[model samples]
Target: MLDESLLDDPEALARADRRELLRGAAEAGARVRTAVRHATEAGIAELKPDGRPRAVLIAGPGLAATGVAELLGTLAGASCPTTRLTPTGVAPASGALRWELPGWAGPVDLLLIATPDGSEPGLELLVEQAYRRGCSVVAVAPAGTPIVESVQGTHGLFVPMATAPYEPTEPLAASAPGVLWALLTPLLVLLDRTGLVSAPPEALEKVADRLDSVAERCGPAIAPYSNPAKTLAAELAEALPVIWTEGTSAGPAGRRFTAALAELAGRPALTAELPEALAAHSVLLAGALAAGADPDDFFRDRVEEAQALHARVVLLRDRPAGGLTAAPAARELALSHDTAISELEPEEGGELETLAELIAVTDFAAVYLALASRA
Candidate 1:
């Protein structure tokens, strides 16, 4: 019989899994760093700006671009001016940084391309232009995209874009500001600490303090026994085989959840949407449910829709009638019919109990082991 008691202490299970996942992530990051170091040493020398250029942010229709622009503006301090780039007109400036688009005369000190998925063709062109212009190019791609390869080939610098995970009411547009700020604030502080950018010590300290607070409050829930991050990662890894068959949102959530888990486990989480990372997991999970071997298939099928709604769906084996998990079969059917998926939980009742149950059955050890599998 399946040991149900393991589901009783989800946190403990997650913690045990997270340790391994975190270590694996660290190793992966180190490899990436080595590649970056080699690229920086051999390909393109660092661009040293004679003076700060008037930064111009090309406002694309994408939410992530707008968010990055706003973040840069805030962190660069009041001296830097930001102008919107449109199809019709260009802002009057001698030296300016254009984000994503490279339509400007004269020299650009820094060119940054920010995209949610890092799949923009325009970004490729912009990097080429930056190479031609001898300007510093920073491409902010979704984590795990071939950004490193692209940048390395282009002989440009690649900075992994980072964002905080927050459950907002709407799409990224609604919560971009806060998330961007959270990411940029820490980055700016780190830059200042390393002396890459000049800022007063007190000012830097304030930013660091704020970042610490944000990490404590909004960061992933972490513990030795049941780290939310590790548990999420393991869940994603196990579900990887059928991730794509699941809804896009669910896929991203799984990715993001796994990334978050990796970070909490003391590794560098990918700086892209969660769905991307968990794409494989979602497909596998969906396929597994389709196969119908697991008893939790009914609730598992609805995970994506529930995540999209930002509502937690718990599958309770024994509960009152007409509750959230009351009709698992119906929930699965409804989820199958829908286009989006949200967080799904298959278990008995009570919030704590549900969390425990999900954790108990999942192979936290396997998830941790997968992290080690990364080269």
Candidate 2:
């Protein structure tokens, strides 16, 4: 178990936070609320749909792109066809690569560009491509950045990033969550306007409220015994965490958790959809059991020298609404191998509220895990 005493000691927790990431984590609620207010006040509801597009393309660079891709993918399911641009390699020069998307010649393709800082070579290339192809583009970026300048000549909508209390960073824990909110806020507004998704004004407020509740529950002053995030951290310490979730909304939430664990806690976590993960991880658990056993004592020397195997399962579920197919089988396998399990479920609310709850909890867990390990 983690040093539970540190969970309630602000000084000790601050010391454990080597990079001062906790400030950003603590303010996540306010940041999200601001994002919602900003998007609502920006007059996105006034936008008129220029007919339904053939497909939606979400493009960006770095962690910003990941957030956009996840949210867009979730909202796009069975409603609008969607594609994501992978920001891996060097971007092509302007007009060097022509987009061959079907129906690009007309107002049938919508490209949403996300660049929090508004300056990236690949994203710039994408903007240029969009301008050349006469594709409708929507952008979320900081005002006065290169991307805003680049979009001057195009038929694009630009939503400036909401005011941040501090300078943001690239790591998920440091700044990505806030930026994620900024990018998603306007998109949610547009989705609502298009009848693609239902994100009422009250929905945004509910999401913010959910985040606030999570922040209070996971704050440093909360005792570990009462704090779900801290408790999860204690369970995850000295163990490899395998995070899985069922349902469209929870899938992205799981991915965000893995990213936080890997980046903030410096712990590698595996994330996957359920049932499929059950089968694959079942084999893994069986392998760990075989590796750790010394049934015949013939290879006792090698067995004794082997590193300790500590695998933990973390299941994120939206229960009573979405059901799991192989949770029972997976639980049986994990129990047989003596692997610990941690399950996280969001408080009852809308999709955004549930997502905010899961994300806030996991974010605090990652930070607490990092602090506890340092201690």
**TM-scores for candidates 1 onward, in order:** 0.35, 0.85
lDDT of 2 by residue, 1-375 (tens): 356578779888876765655666666667666766666566677878866677788876555567767777686677887777655543533223223334444456788877665656556666778777878888887778887867765757777776566553533332234556667777887777777777877888787778778878888888888999899988887677888787667788888878777766678888877878877777776665332343444544654564354678888876533454666776776778766788888867888888778877887888888777763
lDDT of 1 by residue, 140-238 (tens): 444566545666577655555443332323233311222333223333433333334444434434333432332332222443244433434333332
RMSD of each: 15.8, 4.3
Error of 2 at 359 (Å): 1.5
Q: Any runs in candidate 2 off by more than 4 Å, and if so which? A: 1-5, 16-20, 90-106, 168-175, 289-307, 320-325
In angstroms, give how far residue 46 of model 2 lies from its true place: 0.9
Span of ten consecutive residues with least summed lDDT in model 2: 92-101
Error of 1 at 124 (Å): 1.4
- The lDDT for every candidate, in the order shown, is 0.37, 0.71
